[model samples]
Target: MPTDLSPVDDALADALDDERTRQRETLSLVASENYASEAVLAAQGSVLTNKYAEGSPGERYYGGCEHADAVERLAQERARELFGADHANVQPHSGTQANLAAYQALLDSGDTVLSLELRHGGHLSHGQPYTMVDEHFDVVHYGVDPETGRLDYDAVAARATETEPDLIVSGYSAYPRAVDWERMQTIAEDVGAYHVADIAHLTGLVAAGVHPSPVGVADLVTGSTHKTIRAGRGGMILCGEERADAVDTAVMPGCQGGPLMHNVAGKAAGFAEALTPAFDVYARQTVENAAALADRLQTRGFDLVSGGTDVHFALVDLRETHPELTGAAAEAALESVGLVANKQTVPGDHRSATVASGLRIGTPAITTRGFDAAATERLADALVDVLDAPDDEAVRDDARETVAELCRQFPVYDGGAVASA
Candidate 1:
């Protein structure tokens, strides 16, 4: 019943159809994941991928660059407006590389840098020992307050004042609260340090006006396009006009060689879509759905880390649900059902980070699929049902069937109908 297709096109089309099948079949709760739009996909697959421009727009090392100029310039202008930055560099290949480039532009070898500890919700690129930047820079640690489960500005300030660091970073991979940029700026100013706000998780929210922008407060900003922006995987660095040249230079020569032009075009499409008014509603609803899910889990006797959330993610402590359940067992059991999520370590966790005591659930993908509070409530009920009967293969299979039914009803992909397997 299918139309005739060329061999190459048919193979590619089959791959895309398989992708659609996967998205429709699974409930993605990974915080860093999102479904890029059709426009984004087109841009990424555009002819821009053939270019080898090695430098910034208008100053490329290569000779032939008529279209690359337009694509790169459009990306820069849109990013500048969307984030309220004086100038934007659309070149960094990943958020980690973006942070590394910023450090390259600012700090000297072995210069002391301050950031949140990775185990306590910070990213590895933010001075984790495993990253190469650790050897280039002397790293000190900070963390959220034990009582509040949010960034303790006073503690960060005190650390900055005491250490007199070169750069002060305020960002997280797992933090769920909105950052206090003003306080962060103040602390950086007092200690004569440069501030970098990694708003990777909140870029769409900030662009949509659902969350406050962090571009002007910090000297530098780094973001990921996939998390909140609904773009494909890529990184971006934004800076004030004064440092734009240095930032660009650092990202190019200092950190990486060639740029991911395809990803940059995808970022361009994402930025355009984020500037729309409806995205504001979507971003707002993401937080609402997260809050609703967290509340439902709490009412169902799960202990939420930091008690709750103000954003799209929640780190849930599962001791109440199953006192003897290790996070590894919980994750396997939950996955056996269709309620997908990841095991995460909580503060004072008794188990290893890899085998955590809790699971981290996010709302971005389901939110993209149009699952609101009522549907999320059903999700919470499914989780509770699984926990209530941990060993029930029948229950797990039933839950998976239930999830597949929901997925079938609310299919992903631009066609509205999920491609048949």
Candidate 2:
């Protein structure tokens, strides 16, 4: 499929081919990235992209939406079944869009919002200053405990009481531990605030029942399809029947226009795959691999946020064991040896976000590549070797060799060919 592109547009196709080569060659530790299946890829690249279904299934603003409506309804049904929610909106273009819709449906223009601080693992859509959310709503923030690197529920409750916010947002972008949805719901209820759970990173884990779900607990649930869910690249919102019309209206006429029907097809295809027993095994291995990675890194003297993880990633605070090393430097050193990851800010970190004091390493992509705990540990050791001697070309060379061996042993696609149609 990749080869077919060159005949139409050589330059664009070559660029895509290069990206395909890079993915097959390097190791991805990015927490939010995952490889969709061949069926999903095909569905995303199908003729459905030509459709303009601007409204919900069975009701479109344009003509010739029969098949589009069918696909959208299938996606909605699969999403509802997968997450066990009463209503699902599969038209959002991204997670942040879904969040925007939730806000539109639940909050007034100047309503107060309480969410986690970005430096301590909150998403920008959760009211980071200068964003649309911050401009429209009065946004306040809570932080993880500096000492334990975990959420302080009591502190959050106190903050909610003091602020008297209209809505409270749970879920995170880089946090490694599990969240207490019931505690958060109680806090919001006590303060007369709506609860919105953005489980963008936890969708697949929750669907497989490997992690706690917020579908029935929170007032609204928002997530991205392509993270751990591997349901192509889009956003979704799940809510009770009472709020279904508001959510659907906000997503369509309120913010977004025509839905991305091709991505919807991809979502349906991927969600079908997710319903299988094999996907459950994959989700379990993903978490187990993360635990193994965390344990091995800690044993190698790296200090992790909360000292461990209960999810598909680990946040390594470089301030302790590697006092002189910045997360950016560690990321570059690892990338030099073909390991791809992102730098992040740890709790109490004063460093700028560009050169953070922590690394957010994840197992979702690698686990999708079929890695076991033994393989994950081996990769961790290679990662440490590079950090232990960043200036030494010999160390990087050895690490690169290890990455090549692992990539060859577990090719992302059959025969190392990328299936991007």
Candidate 3:
């Protein structure tokens, strides 16, 4: 039985209950989101949160860390096994932090770093102006091929050579195709630059062997635990034995303090789940569902970036299909009908970041709820209906009804129980 939060915090508990109800009823299509399993949730909300293990597993600054150490060790071991890395640091609080520590470990201040442009599917930590990385490093950006909306390795190589960067950052936030890690490695090698592959969005796919792994190919790798991996919110860094000490130190006293042991336990549970054969099936289905979504949307006259997807999401470039419709307008229209997705910047986008020209719809969350290709096609149809008539009250009403029916068919959480705040 779960402890009731109503007695201690009625207001917060009510809000949490409302949020749970929202998730149970809506079709969440956010590309970076996923529904963690109950086991992972329990581990995240466990008692380990109270402890302060300021150092690595076996070398803690505080006492009474036996269980914390054990959990961290298990999480690291599982991560190494899952991604085939020589070492794993499950300490950084988020993917951004993991990238920061990786940069600190590999390069010095003022060293040039070459990475993808933020509007071109790269993360903010990869050298956005607002980040500390930008303040410390000389950052150069490479962009995707405008014709294909895919990374052009030749362009990246040319950019690396032009900048003579100390590090080259690969992997992305919104790209929908498989990356050639080996080719990127070769480019970094030719430029004499260390490669840091930020696989924050494809952690589970790589772990399940559905996507190419960058662990052994890249000089350093980083990822988020919560995105595709179904772990609690956290970050991880993977590196070879030669760089293990530097990466570990950079993650600890270099960027952060005590580790979140409960989240580490959650990572362990999530990685263990990923090791099973069932997870491989889930990973493959995620990609298949995205492909189905792309097909359905393209059939309805929508223009998808790259013409389709090779991963768990599809980027719909709405410029040609709906020139007057901004991504923000489409996002609101879909949300009104219980289909939640985020506005995104497509290649050659002229709009601001807040009002992008594209929509990135993902299948990880819906797939976790047991949605297959057929169900995804239905979802795509409903999404198109809303986008086609965003301001029509009758159309939104019909879409909402369809969403409610689909929610009934595929619920996110069993028993519809909302845990206390």
Candidate 4:
């Protein structure tokens, strides 16, 4: 190995190298995560992070604004083209940050906001009692139908009429089926509420033409570039030209300080890559893999929320299959096999966040590594086997071997300009 590390930084460099090797050897199945291409990674590591342009392009609060202006402009333009929105602000640091900005822009303190309940299928930023959303705004919780484990739009409408919230928040972290955004917007409008859609998990599908888009339907749309978009870790707000200044100002002065230009640059690179024909293929395959995994899990007697998935991730209800094992145990067992996944809370779950009753699986990372339906089936088999035999070392070892074979068959690394570097 070529050694250029100084003595003081050598230990840190070695640890980073170990992590890189681990990523190359194992699978990363985290739903909110994806592997970036070499080009995107390189852009994120560029000199851009040194600049501190506190405001939008062409009107910065600092010197040497030309390049930062270009970077931010590229990100904004790509967002507009990808989502067909009138304006885009690529400033918020993450999905939650974007939601905070949207809330700041549209609602006042104590204003009621209707959102999916966190334990049922919503993000904490939507309004868990311990979060800032809950502290500053009154939250009206909606949830999936008790029988179907799907969003009860009728109930949501009824709740909206009763709460008369200032904003109706749509989109979800664990919903398997699509939300009726058109109807949702109508309900919000009738209740005199602003409709905001957080499309963080489904953005890439919308970009790839595989999933329905809420871009033109919702008054304000926010999403993370990292999830389905497969960009660097950051958030963006897309809205109409009428709401541009409000959204921008809220994100800038009201919420965060100077933007992380490196993240912004990576967002632009990822957005550019998302617009390509090959990325469209990848996005399509992502859904295909997810659907296959859900189906196979159901076939193996594990319950899937909402029947199955039409997106990149799904929730597996473990009550029937592993009735005695907690979600945390199942998650750990799967991890021991090198099949990465997270414990999640299912609707009607008796368990809380610490030991929930569901598992969240996504196909983005495996799909990005070129795995498809067959690979998803194999992954599902490994998860089911591990969960079934949580105490069996032999079962764990076999699953690990299977995972290794899958990784070997579908190797992934940063593939653009940075590959050479």
Q: How does each model score on lDDT?
A: 0.80, 0.93, 0.90, 0.87
Relative to the unseen true structure, what is the C-alpha lDDT of residue 59 in candidate 1, on a scale of 0 to 100?
85
lDDT of 1 by residue, 90-112 (tens): 78888888888888888888888
Q: Clash number for model 1?
A: 0
What TM-score against the true fold does each predicted structure earn? 0.93, 0.98, 0.97, 0.97
Predicted candidate 3 versus true structure: per-residue lDDT over 147-221, tens digit per residue? 999999999999888889999999999889999999999999998999999999999999999999998999999
How many pairs collide in each candidate, listed in order?
Answer: 0, 0, 0, 0
Number of the predicted model whose TM-score against the real structure is largest: 2
Which parts of model 1 have CA positions greater than 4 angstroms off? Answer: 1-17, 319-323, 417-421
Candidate 2 per-residue C-alpha lDDT over 144-249 given as tens digits, one digit per residue, 9 for 90 to 100:
9989989999999999999999999999998899999999999999998999999999999999999999999999999999989888799999999999999999
Better of 2 and 4 by lDDT: 2
**CA-only RMSD, every prediction:** 3.0, 1.6, 2.1, 1.9
Q: Indicate the residue-level lDDT of 195 in model 3.
A: 96
List runs of model 4 lying over 4 Å from the truth.
1-8, 414-421
Q: Which of the predicted structures, 3 or 4, would earn the higher TM-score when compared with the native? A: 3
Pick out the ten consecutive residues of candidate 1 with the lowest summed lDDT.
412-421
